[model samples]
Target: MMLANVGTADRIIRIIIGLAIIAWSISAENLWWILGAVVLATGVFKFCGLYKVLGISTQGSTSK
Candidate 1:
């Protein structure tokens, strides 16, 4: 698959955020699974709904 540049950045950011959330959740007795789901969805789809709704596109239409 010719994954877009946005995809890469999205995946990386999602994972980082997910890890942070999970860490905080673990320390605060919260749900880590929520963050896991967000990370999974973003990583699998390579598209972030929040990013889309905000009209943010990190990559060109074509993957380089």
Candidate 2:
């Protein structure tokens, strides 16, 4: 299994923000759903590819 670098709090916030953005984008007929998808993916999976590339992790040691 792959390690999850995203912390619980961060994941929650991401999901909330992603949903909000997606809702707003849909109402405005924009393509921001792509961004929402990325955010949701990272939060759901508890992993962030950009975080890994930048060597940044929010997860605690025990979680890793």
Candidate 3:
């Protein structure tokens, strides 16, 4: 399975960031919700583009 670890801290941070973005969108009427959307998307995919660029995989073995 390619879907591996994605530790607890990262998961929580992603969720918090996404919620914050969405919240900011409502309160500040900014486009920061896109950040939230990205966070949510990353959580769903269990993959981060930045992480890949940095050659990092917290999700255990990326090789399926």
The numbered model that scores best in TM-score is 2
Off by over 4 Å in 3: 1-5, 61-64
- What lDDT score is found at residue 59 in candidate 1? 62
Question: How big is the positional error of residue 20 in model 3, measured in Å on the Cα after superposition?
Answer: 1.5
Provide TM-scores for the models. Answer: 0.55, 0.90, 0.71
Give the top-scoring candidate (lDDT). 2
lDDT of 3 by residue, 1-64 (tens): 3443455578778878888788989799888888889997777667777877677777664443
**By TM-score, how accurate is candidate 2?**
0.90
Error of 2 at 9 (Å): 0.6
**Order of candidates by TM-score, top first?**
2, 3, 1
Mind giving the per-residue lDDT tens digits that candidate 2 earns over 1-64? 6689999999999999888888988999999988998898899999999999899999978822
Question: How many clashes show up in model 3?
Answer: 1
What does candidate 1's lDDT look like per residue over 1-64, in tens digits? 4333356766777777777777788788878868677876676567666666678777657734
lDDT at position 6, candidate 2: 98
Error of 1 at 43 (Å): 3.1
Per-residue error (Å), model 3, residue 25: 1.7
* Alpha-carbon runs more than 4 Å astray in model 1: 1-5, 32-36
- Candidate 1 matches the true fold with a TM-score of 0.55
